[model samples]
Structure formats: C-alpha cells, structure tokens
Target: MQIPWEERYAFMTKTHIETYELVEECLKINYFGMKYLTEALLPLLESSDSGRVVNISSNAGRLRFLNNEGLVKELDDINNLTLEKLDDLVKSYLKSFKEGALEENGWKLPGGFGTYKASKIFVNAYTRIAAKMYPNLYINCVQPGHTQTEGSSCTGSQTVEEAAKSPVMLALDDSGQTGFFYDHTEITAYY
Candidate 1:
C-alpha cells in the first residue's frame, strides 16, 4: 500500500526560496503524512506476527546532508530523542525558513532542496523512534537509489521498478531487524 505524491516544488533551492506555505506543504506530504499513516495503522501491524515497516526514504535523508552540526548530533542521539523534540526541531527549521535564515541557522543543504531534505531527515529519525518504541515490529528506512521519477526530473539512471526493489525487499524481510537505514539492500550508517 504505497501512496505516492509528486514534489512539484523539488526545484526550490537556496537562491530560489519557496514560500512558507510551500515548505510546510512539503513537510506535510513527505514527513507528517507518513507518520500519521503509520501511527493510524500501528495497531493492525502490531497484531501481525511479522509486522514490518519499510519507509521509502532517500539518500538526502542522511545526516551528512545537513550542514548543522548541532542538528546532526541531536538527530543522531536516538536514545534520548522524543517525538516532541523531533517536532520542535522541525518547527525550528520552519522558523529558519520563514526568516530567510536557513543558511545562517545551519538548516540549509549544500545543493539546496532544504525543505525536502529536512523532511526526509525527519522521516528517517521518526523511523528510528518508532522502531525503538515497538520492539515487536520490524521497522527500517531505505534509500531506493536515484530513480527516474518526476521528483528527479527523469535524470536519474534507475527506473521506478529498479528503485522499488530495495524497499520491497525490506518489507518482506523476516530477519527482525529494526531501526536501520539501508542503501539499496545493504545496511548503512545513518550518520
């Protein structure tokens, strides 16, 4: 049950600042939508013997994508992370974006796409949190490689089917691994 949405504002960069509404919309679709959906279905998933959650994350979600050392450390501290803290971090990012101070505030990425990157970063973090909270379930996030989707302007080398393999593999995995980030089917460092 994969629900997809086109990121029409994927072209937004540091120089081409997007509106607050647009930035928020990106977060809503990329992060909040997934979060709410998973939470809503958690009970059903929990009842299953092999419940699994394979979040379709991106390489852009890597902690290295962030220029802010503090933020990176905060996100990496999964043991102490809370949903409230994550929400606050996102609100701070939104404030920085609204103030036109993303770069100064260390919320901007090198190649831009700050909003999208931040949203994915949050998704990765939320994946970890959920996994920790639900030890009975297998929860992980995977970077499906650069696929030629509308978001990538069809410049990516891989087709949509090629990109689907990693996530689908993770979804069907019965190893009981949780709170991991995968680069294609292999486990990778989140930081």
Candidate 2:
C-alpha cells in the first residue's frame, strides 16, 4: 500500500540529520547555490547599461577584525598566502561576480551555522576587491542587522522587516557607490 500524503510530506521536511551532516549540507547548498545564481546574473548585468548586484551579507562579516579568534585560519596556509593563490581566487570570484555567478572558493566551516558568517565574510571581501577590479559594476553587501528570521531562530532583537530595511536600501541606492556595506539603511564600516 502507498504511504499517506501527510506522512510523505512530514518525511520530506524532517530535520533529523546529525549536526555534522547538517553543517555539510548547509555549506554545500549555500555555497553552490550562490555561485550558480551569481553566474546567471552576470551576463544580464554586463549587457545592461546600469545595474547592481547586492549580496545579503551580515554583521558577522565585520567580526573578522574585531574577533579574529573565530576567524577561519584554514586558508592561512603558507602556500595559500602566495600572490598566485590570492590572485587566482580574486580573479575567479570577480569573473563570476562581474558575469553574475558566485563561486565560493573559501573553506566551509565544520559546522554549517557559522558558515553563514564565513560566507558573509567572503562576500564582503569579494565585494571590496571586485569593486576595485570591476569599477563599472556595482557590487556590494548589505547587513540586515539582527532580524528575527527563520535562520535567526527568532532570537534577534529586531523584526524581520526591520532587518530587511538595510538590504532594501542598498538595492535601491543610485548614488553610484560600489563595494559598500550598510547597516540598517545607514553606511557602516565593514572590515
């Protein structure tokens, strides 16, 4: 006999994976999804006379300098520090960003939760570097602040709408500024 429709739906939505598996899955999906989406947007932007590609990053991206302790040191290998490695990563990310694909070449944190923070960090760096490399493109990341969203576990002090204000502002900005980060609709220092 066939299983009930409700049972099948429940099975599909179940979040019973072990912590490790969950993290791996999150990283794989998040990184690859962003890369693919960005890649698709590049061409459209290139052909357009004016356009902007805004990434939804987080305040966690700014934690790098202030909280160096949590920063991933895996990419700090001596070999990775070479100009060649840096150049290649920058070039690859820029090509995708300029073209509209976002391939994350950085390491995925062992736990998927922090990976979001790391992703934001990568996005922030890529934004700054890409802006300089492709002056014609408006590439930037906007921190929505601590908003109460599903991913935020509803623990944040701000509402989802409040958190979204910053990203919305960045998306609508026509000031010609690129590679900038905004916090709650205002320009904020990131990194």
Candidate 3:
C-alpha cells in the first residue's frame, strides 16, 4: 500500500482548508487504492485454496487515535458495518476536514497527519468488513512498526528489515485468523 508521505509532509503545518486537496490525494492513494486493488483481485484470490490479502497499516490507525467516540464505536461494530456506511463515515470525515472543524468534531490528532491516520483507520475498518464478507479469504491488516523510511524522514527507530517481519509473518501464516489487527507479530485490539 502507498503511504503518500510526500503529500502528508506538505500539509503537516497547514490548515485543513489549505491542505484539502493534498489530503484528498493522500486518501486516494492510501485508502481508495488499496480498496480498489483488493476488489479487482478478489476473483483471482477466491480461486486459491488459501487466499490472503495483508494490508499494511500503522499504529496511528488505532481507533484510540480518533477522539470521536461515536465514530470509534461505529467502526468497531464490524458485524453491523457495511461498505456504504464506512464510505459515508469517510465522507463525513472529509466534510469536517474541509470545513476546518476537525478539532471541533473530535477527528483531530495530536501531532497532525490527521489525514493519514484517518486513511489507515478506514483501511483497518475495510479489512475487517472484507474479511467478514469473504470467509474463504484470509484478510488481515498489520502495523509494521516504525521503520526507517523516506516517509518518516529516516527518523523511525526500526530498520526496514526489522519492520518487515510482522507483515511477512502474516502473509505466510496459515492460522485462519481474519478480521484482526497485529502490532508487529502480536495480535492487538483495534483501539
């Protein structure tokens, strides 16, 4: 999955209005790109006996990063969530973002990168929904720790190789565990 950190950095210090387009671009690359790619590959994936789709997510994507309790509850209710509702929730986030009311609406993050955080949150939610919808597929998302990469300005604590272990583990495992989040190699709560 593409992280779109160049766009993220450009808008880091700007107001939501000033960065609206960049934020939208990030969402298109980070969230929509993953969603569409998975959809397009579903047929082929279903043909395999052990189809797997491992989404690369982030620690910032945790539901606790979102101050909006209602939104958190909505996303966590995977059994009740639908694709349309999840899309609508993302639309609501963008609307609030455009209006410069993210903080007022409880969607703001502490050190900015709110768009990235929201995008990954949507990704995690989408992974859960897809896993439920397609029981035959082993779909999951993983937070490959903070690795040194261009997106992070090379300030992350872990090396690229170190950060890759968790995702690689998920991709190769045949545990039949779906619709869950992993922090490195361990299963964790979405919040």
Candidate 4:
C-alpha cells in the first residue's frame, strides 16, 4: 500500500519526448486547428453580415507573462502580422524549445505553461489579424477567467457559468469593436 510520490507525479510531469509531442499537439489542436477550421469556414462567415468569432482565451495569454519586449511587439503588430508570419513565429518558438534556448530566445513560460500560453497568444494575434482581414465580421478573444473547470486543473475560483459569460457576451456583442480583448466582461487592450 506504500506508493512512491514519484509515481504520483509521473503522469503530471512529462519526458522530453512527451514535451515535444505535447508542443506539436498543442500547436495543432490550439493554433493550426483553429486556423484551418476558420479558413474552411471563411466563405460561410463572409456571407453573413453578422459573422462573429469569440475565441476562448486565457489570462495566460496576457502579454505581461511574455516578458519579451521584442516578441511582444511582433505579436502585437496587427498591421504586419500575417497568418504565414504567425506560423513562422510558432516554428521559431518550437525551435527554441528544442535547442534549450527558450529563455535566451525570450520564451519564459516553462514547458507546458509555455506551450499553452504561446497557443493562446497565437490565438489572440490571429484574432487581431483576422479581424483586420474581415472588417465586417466581429472577431475577438475573450479570457474566460480562471474558473472551476477541468481545464483549469481545479484551481479556479469562479463557476463554469461565470466563465461562460465572457465568450457568450463577446459572441453576441455588436458594439463594432473588433480585434479587441475582453478580460471577462470589459474591453481592454491586450498589450
């Protein structure tokens, strides 16, 4: 009946192989998955005058966690940040991860947190760039706030209902404020 603590932590932590697999899967499911889906639906979205994209983002995506001034600028440059460019940024981040140069290259989130944060950051940047591409459509990123959900590792303080409101509100908003970030319920600059 004596179980080692390492046994408990084993699944919580990961191997180098797991990290690489996770990073790639994270990009695929979080960033590229969204990208391809949106592209596939662009025609339908374009046809409707009320098209809206409310991406469920997180506080982890906030620029304050990034800490790299140069990277922040690149991520925030809505005018010049294209879809192709975003892919390049993701590629560079992955390269830095593999080379053990994350801190040297400016990524500071540390492994899984770094990947999730980077994914959301990519989603936020994509929201900005896409909103610019389709001015008529309402596209924005909404931070659902840390809520008591399975995804939050059960560390959240808010209810699932409370967390759902942010994206739902953004989905229904017609204030003409596209390419913006919402901290739960308030409109704010992401950077």
Candidate 5:
C-alpha cells in the first residue's frame, strides 16, 4: 500500500491507538500530576499574599480543537465543572483510547499529538477550574512556545530563551490575573 507523503505527514503523529499506556502516561503526568502538586501546595500558596500558580501548558491543549458542542459547554462551565466531573471526563477519554475511537468521538486533529492534547486539554481546564475555586490565587497557564527542550528531542522551532520569558514573566507578575491561558506573553482565552 503506497500511501502518499501528504497523507502520511498529516497523520505522522496520529493513528488509532493500539496501546493505552501512552495515553495513560500523558494523563497521569500532564493532568493529575499537576492537580496533585497544586493540592499539596494549596496551603503554602494560600499563605502568600501574592500567590501564583503557573502551569506550563501547551497550545495543543486549547479548546479550539474540540468540536464536541456538549463537551465544550461542560468544560466551559467552570462553576459546574467540579473535580469529580473532570475526573470522570478523564476516565471517559481513556475509555475512548481503549476503544480506538477518539477521532470519532469529536476529539480531532491530534494525529500523533492525541495523548498530549488530551492530557493538556485537562491541564488548561483545570487551571481555570482551580483559579475560580480560589479567587485570591493568581493561577495562570502559559504555552511557553515550542522550544528545543529534551522533551521535544530538540526539534522545536523556538529557543529556550524565547520560551522561558513567558512563564517567568507570568510568575513574577503580581497583577492578580487568574484562570487565564497565554500564548507566549499575551493574555488570551483558553480556546
């Protein structure tokens, strides 16, 4: 079967999953890992007058990729998006992975980026959810532009210097901005 390069490139990072470990790992680290750490640090963060919770997330996690109207409405409704509900969503996502039906279920364009996107989607959502839960905390998530980090195998276009600025600046900013997503240095919507 001679698949064209264009088609291959389109899906270079995508395909129906034959293994669930990759998705599981992504969820464990990207979403739950952040959640657990933040929970453990809530006391310290609360004690500080200018508490900042900076989650280094990726642009891949944005809500734009989601075409599922119902899902969008649910995640967007922070007041109703409880931790238990979010956990349920994660569980459902994993179920989709096991069934190899992510694309069919309205999660799209992930290609090889499926699991990362899946986990990050939650990261962004949780960032907002937590921020609303704790009004005083300066909780924000930033997409530190694609950088040539070891995690990306040094393949990202932006240099570490460029990427570092956004997160660092957000960390130092005492502007009381919370539950927002950033594209580099600019304040932006979660989508």
Candidate 6:
C-alpha cells in the first residue's frame, strides 16, 4: 500500500508556519489521545474476558535520544544527538506515567512537544507497569509501520487496516504478553 503523507497544515499561511502548526497538532493529538485511551477505554476492555488495549503510537515515540534505564548513551551504531536531554525527557514521561502530572499547577510547560513524545513513551511505559500491577490485563502499543490514516494522511506503505494488524495481533495474543510493542506481527522494543 502507498499512502500519501497527510498534509496536516493545508490551510496554513506559510510553509514554516505550517510545519510548526502540524507538529503542534500532532503533539496535542498524542497527549490527549493517550489520556482518553487510559481513562475512558481501558476500563471497559479490562472488564471483558478477552481484554486487550492497543495504542497506535509512532516510531517517533521511540525516543532515540535516550538509552534504556535513562542512563548512558544508547548510540553505538545508532545516532547520539541529545541523549542527556532525551534521558531527562524520558524520565519525565516515566514519572508522569507512573504517577500522572505534567504540571503541578495543571498546565503544560513551555516547549512541550517533548512532552507529547514523552506522553507516547509513557503510554508504553504505563502498559508495562500496568501489566505488572494487574496480572490479568493484556495491554500493548503498536508502531503501526508508517501507515496512512486521517491524521497522517497517506504517507506510508501500509493502509489503516494493514497498519491495524499489529494492534489486532496483540489483542488476540492468547499467550498473555503485555506491555510489548509490535509492528504488525513482530515484537519490537522501544527502549
């Protein structure tokens, strides 16, 4: 499948402005979107026998800036742009996910695009932590392989249904593997 990149800022006044606006919108979608999934959707799913919760995250949420455990650099064969800042950001994400509070005063911080990324990162983290906290829940996140969707436009080789396979696979994972990340049928890690 060949999906075109969705033009998120088609109505923008200029190119640079459009780019910024699109990123902003992506951040908002990610933040509130995950919140909704956790608050509204997960409970209902958990009540079912074949309970499953799948979040369609992005490779962008992988946070290449930090290594696992938020320690040293995760960049040997990989890139090493801003591992320190990435660690801090990932820590903030984990903190929020484990606890929940981007702001003490109930507001977003300045330059919160990282927070958006952190929110996605935290979703996967929460998936893991929640699974540990509750033994019977099956929760996972899917990168979805650059699929074409309403927000993403059509900019990938996968269709919505095709990209949807990863989540679907996790949902049907009778083996009970929780907090894993899948890109269709394959299992991949984000840290």
CA lDDT of each candidate? 0.87, 0.57, 0.87, 0.82, 0.83, 0.55
Tens-digit per-residue lDDT, 162-190, candidate 6: 87777777767898787677766777866
Ranking by TM-score: 1, 3, 5, 4, 2, 6
For residues 54-173, what per-residue lDDT tens digits would candidate 3 score against the true structure? 999999899998887888899999889999998888887788889988888777876677788899999999999999999999999999987789887664678999999999999998
lDDT (Cα, 0-100) at 110 in candidate 6: 34
| Model 5 lDDT per residue over 12-75, tens place | 4454353688778878988999999999999999999989989999988878777787888888
Candidate number with the higher TM-score (1 or 2): 1
Candidate 2 vs candidate 3, lDDT winner: 3
**lDDT (tens digit, per residue) of candidate 1 on 1-191:** 32232342343342355689999999888888998999999999999999999998889999998978898999999999998999898888999988999888889887767788889899999999999999999999999987788777665668999999999999899888999999999999997
Clashes of each: 0, 7, 0, 0, 4, 7
Which stretches in model 6 have alpha-carbon errors above 4 Å?
1-28, 67-116
- Candidate 2 on 1-191: residue-level lDDT in tens? 64554554355336324254444455445444554576588788778766677877777666443233323352233223333444454345344434433324333323223445555665665566556555777877887776556664444567877777777777677888886877767778775
lDDT of 4 by residue, 33-61 (tens): 98888888889988998988888778778
Instruction: Please estimate how well model 5 matches the true structure, expressed as its whole-model Cα lDDT.
Output: 0.83
Q: What is the alpha-carbon lDDT for the whole of candidate 2?
A: 0.57
Instruction: Provide TM-scores for the models.
Output: 0.90, 0.62, 0.89, 0.87, 0.88, 0.59
**Which of candidates 3 and 5 reaches a greater lDDT?**
3
Model 5: CA > 4 A from native: 1-18
For model 4, the superposed segments whose C-alpha errors exceed 4 Å read 1-18, 110-112
